[model samples]
Target: MAELFQIAGAGDPRLRDYTDLRDVSLRKLLETERGLYIAEGEKVVRRAVEAGHRPRSLLLAPRWMESLADVLEATDAPCYVLDEKTIEQVTGFHVHRGALAAMERPEPLSPETVLASARRVLVAEDLVDHTNIGAVMRNVAALGFDAVLLSPRCADPLYRRSVKVAMGAVFSLPYARIEDWYAAPDLLREHGFTSYAMSLAADSVPLDAIEIAPGERVAVIVGSEGPGLTEHWQQAADHRVTIPMAAGIDSLNVAASTAIACWHFRPR
Candidate 1:
């Protein structure tokens, strides 16, 4: 059974976890310090619960009760039932999804654990844009990719925008951060993975040109939006792959590039 409360004002202290959602810096600091992440919409809320994340509390309009009754029943967390207007005022945005939950952030898995069963992995280095990060995750999950590895400076995949843009893909995909940036190339080689750095270098191979034997392990590395892979990381790859462009267009955005790479490099 879940405890239900009524919230009439956005200023209510009980809604602290849902406040200032539009303030990125504030939300990042608050969510990190408090070990909580916001799960919005009924589907995302359910996915978060399904992924074994604990709920500290839930904020939703009355309409979502029936749809999420099972999830609420499973948690003893307080459920703050508010109207749509109150939700908007509290969250600093329109709560079009009609539901949101404050979920406890799960402990991050190590690089080794995430890679144990992964054959075709996407490695992100310093991809700080939350939308791009989520889009990549969505594509990776939809494609046949096995897992994802993030560099130390990557953005939070659990961030609200990331979660929303991913449409719950983040809950299903396995991922971890790599602490040792310089040693990653050797580590991938040791694990029998051919690390291909996605780049535009003149000597880079076309996306479909890479040769992979049956069941050979592979890892594709993508870099940040503003800057592509650093010189050191670029040189660290077993090979470099480039998605050729037409009409004098030099390159695509990070998210698009990742999607094409994921599609082209999908397990064969």
Candidate 2:
């Protein structure tokens, strides 16, 4: 059972894990160095724990204590109770959800290990926006895609804001970061996946037109929101593809585009 401690001030050293949450650079550096990630809100916290992530500790307001009672009871980590004012002071923002948890980051899966069991995969390249990454992860989990492959520069799906926005889909979805961007295209091909790079190039085929051969696997590659896919991936993909749009709109956000492509190429 988690031991409960009352916090009197924001300066308490024990609350270090939950500090400066609004400072992206600080949080990123701290989390990466310590191998810890924060889960915010009640649902995300529950989902993280249920997915087998061990919590280092939980921070909560008094009102939230009863709501997360089961979660706290399952671990021996300390639960630091603080008034809303003190929490705001330490985290640099009001935790409206009233609950937060610092969880030990789990080991990362390798591309080969993830792909071995996955048939339909979504690859995110240079997508640095955490919310977009999280939203795409939810789509990947809900749309029946088998796994996610991320480029070296993609945002961390385990980031606090990302995890909350994903509603914990990050926990259930198997994902890996590709270190060698140059080899990624060939690697997917060797796995027998028909890779389609979502792009705006004139020669790009409509997403619906991609042929799915018998026993053929599929991979959808989505690029960053602003610049879209880099020239390297656009040229390397088996086919450059685009979602046919109507009216004046020529493009959609990566998150929206991903859903349409996932549904179009869903394993049939």
Candidate 3:
């Protein structure tokens, strides 16, 4: 049987969570009775469904409603079918992704637990751009890295744009944020993993030269693109590794660098 939704016009109080002028802070929703982060696009929403994230509700253009039958059937949440203009007005940004979902953030993973069974992990420090963060996670997942550790300054992996850009790999990958960035390397050491900082310093060993022993656990730390790894992280790392590139190129984007580093350190 097809369910029905009586159109709740834009500005209806019940739809407050969906209306926005500025970027709706997912954290802001946590303050109110209904706390949810927005998940955009068809694929991401599908991934969320497959990941067992129940949607509180959905907002989408009328054209998208019929196309997303499988997704709707997977959940009992209300689907607010609207026209494109209505979606644009309510979301503040143009609703290019066609469908959006309101989903609660899942319980975060513990750093120790995320790394418990890992042989290789990727550690990101203060990589703020959502696209870069997503790309990094996608690369990490595709290239055989086992887990991800993030600094406090790293953007939320669950952010809608991040999720979309990552093609939902963020949901599949194991990740946890290190509470104190300064103590992160020590934590890796305590976990019996060797920390290698990815930086471009002349003293740094080339990525290809850093050999890994069989059964040895390793963590690759990538800092923000411009500053590379901080001095404290460098001091804490067992070694500093750099990608060998042409002389004219100053550096690779953090995402590109991450892909290369992760592949080299991937478990054989």
- Best-fitting candidate, measured by lDDT? 2
lDDT of 2 by residue, 46-161 (tens): 99999999999999999999989999989999999999888999999988988999999999999999888889999999999999999999988889999999999999999988
Error of 2 at 190 (Å): 1.8
lDDT of 1: 0.92
For residues 21-133, what per-residue lDDT tens digits would candidate 3 score against the true structure?
24635444441445566788888888887887778788777777777888887777887777777778777888787688888777779999998888899999999888889
Q: Number of backbone collisions per candidate, in order?
A: 0, 0, 0
Alpha-carbon lDDT, every model: 0.92, 0.93, 0.83
Please give the lDDT score at residue 203 for candidate 2.
Answer: 87
C-alpha lDDT of candidate 3 relative to the true structure: 0.83
Q: What is the TM-score of each candidate against the true structure?
A: 0.97, 0.97, 0.92
In what order do the candidates fall by TM-score, top score first? 1, 2, 3
Candidate 1's error at 167, in angstroms? 0.7
